[model samples]
Target: MLHLGKPLVVAIDGPSGSGKSSVSREVARRLGLAYLDTGAMYRALTWHCVSHRIALDDAVAVEAASRALDLELSLSPDQEYVRVAGQDVTDDIREPAISSAVSAVATTLGARTQLVRRQQETIVRAGRRIVVEGRDITTVVAPAAEVRLLLTASEEARMARRGIQLGGSQSQEQLAVQVLHRDAKDSTVVEFQRAADGVLTVDSSHMDFEQTVMAVVHAVLDAVGGHRKNG
Candidate 1:
């Protein structure tokens, strides 16, 4: 087992379909750390707004909704659930409707601010030993984390993986919109496609799930080793 003496915050940023969520969850499970899917937070907020008939374009209303959102999400990798105001919306947030509209909420500066603050609080609540994965987790949410990584993949690979994830229901065009177009819109707000300073990049274009997980695990260990040497 890999354990850092102090709190460990592993922040991972990645584009859509890069497997950040699954890989981060598995990494946390293996390391016995808390797991946080920050993207799901955004998705939950999006679902909340949509369910209430709030206009996505109305930034003010959206921000207000974000502030008032009563969200409960699973912190354990062994369990997965997301609730909004005590209502289970774990699977609803993953719906295509929420995916298509989440960027609007994510790009809203005010809403993002609120959610980022909530995420930071969650980190502190988790004893600061957690694996957090999202679009701007490394840059914005946990910039001072012990381990920061940007997981990326080729567009072709990402599209294929997303298609598989959606169970082949979405057409190629739909996948393009969800994977490529969504990334393009979200990029306007955060630079997740590239790695920031001191952030390692893992191109999982050719690696399988296990390979990618091992690569991230190795990166964590390497970072720990470097920290020991510097200390």
Candidate 2:
């Protein structure tokens, strides 16, 4: 799938806390390609709806908000950000409030369709050579990508990593709801926990961060025959 004299596109799908975002960013940096965090796009929309007092269950209103959302995401690995309505919301979208409500916005088929259209546009605008990572990237967003991978970890590992990131602020029960329950809800919309046909799986259950990064890097290199400093 290597295009002659063009950048390579990499698509990664995984459950939450599977390290797909970090690994995809690192791989894009090493490959000198742009990195697109599709999940952040959803989070930004969720934030907008909540801030505007739009009820997520109102599918029509949510879809309208999605259509009107002035969202922009930077694909640069070193300078990633999300902007909405000319406001910088790079960090706000990661707040716990947004995390808890994002699925409500995401599971709406109308909202998901709007976001998926925008995502495809972003990929095309990148000349089809950016590394895009999210829940459904490999299966729905970029199935034709040069390199497609599903990064996964055991539930225990996922919960542990998320717990460390949350800094023990949430109890185990809360963490389970955030990790497992959220995955269960989101899975109803898109298949993420399993590898799709032609997509490689990278299990990082026992691997450290650096190891996971290398695993993805190797997968991309093996699929597209690209050379990198670390490779």
Candidate 3:
């Protein structure tokens, strides 16, 4: 449904475990657009700080590290990965330790500034035709995107999905900290729990991944019609 001549930029925001990452990636793949995971950028910074033994609570040090962090991220949804300083931390970033500490880095104001600037640069690199998802993408990062969406799910649904991803090994309490607690922490810096004006909201609480993907794709087509108009 995309107009090849005028590439579309889709900005999606959602809480953790709402399926935004998986859904946005699939939508980008279907539309042949680049994908950006802003949350992973924060996670990469967290991984870097942790590797260097930088305390998460040290705001000044974390902000300095954010500016100097060397990160390489893949835009292909099919081959998504993150590398920091030539070291592959793709799998390491998803470990429970990183998940538990990522919000600390994400909540840092100066850190967010650095990452957001890089995100804007990335969007430009994509020719403004990309599917970017994260806490503040629809509002703060790309408020003027061609298509803006906020994906959400009930707490029960979100926890269930994340629990399955964790092989049901994490206790309900552990999952709560990872999902609810993390969202609460990140929400302070970015208002992603609700849809902003001009942003479409998709509740994936009941729908499967394919259904959610279609919902987002429909949002994009609805925004600019099936074709770009002649200037």
Per-model lDDT: 0.93, 0.89, 0.91
Candidate 2 wrong stretches, greater than 4 Å: 1-5, 227-231
TM-score of each: 0.96, 0.95, 0.96
Candidates 2 and 3, the one with greater lDDT: 3
lDDT of 2 by residue, 1-231 (tens): 344558578999999889878888998887778899999999999999999999999999999999999998898999977999999999899888898999999999999999999999999998887999999988889888888999999999999999988888988888887789899999999999999889899999999998898888888877777664563
| Model 1 TM-score on a 0 to 1 scale | 0.96
- lDDT tens per residue, model 1, 130-221: 99999999999999999999999999999999999999999999899889999999999999999999999999999999989988988998
lDDT accuracy of residue 221 in candidate 2: 75
> In lDDT terms, how accurate is model 3?
0.91
Model 3 earns a TM-score of 0.96
Candidate 2 TM-score over all chains jointly: 0.95
Lowest summed lDDT over 10 consecutive residues: which window, candidate 1? 222-231
Q: Is candidate 1 or candidate 2 better by lDDT?
A: 1
List the candidate 3 regions with Cα displacement exceeding 4 Å: 227-231
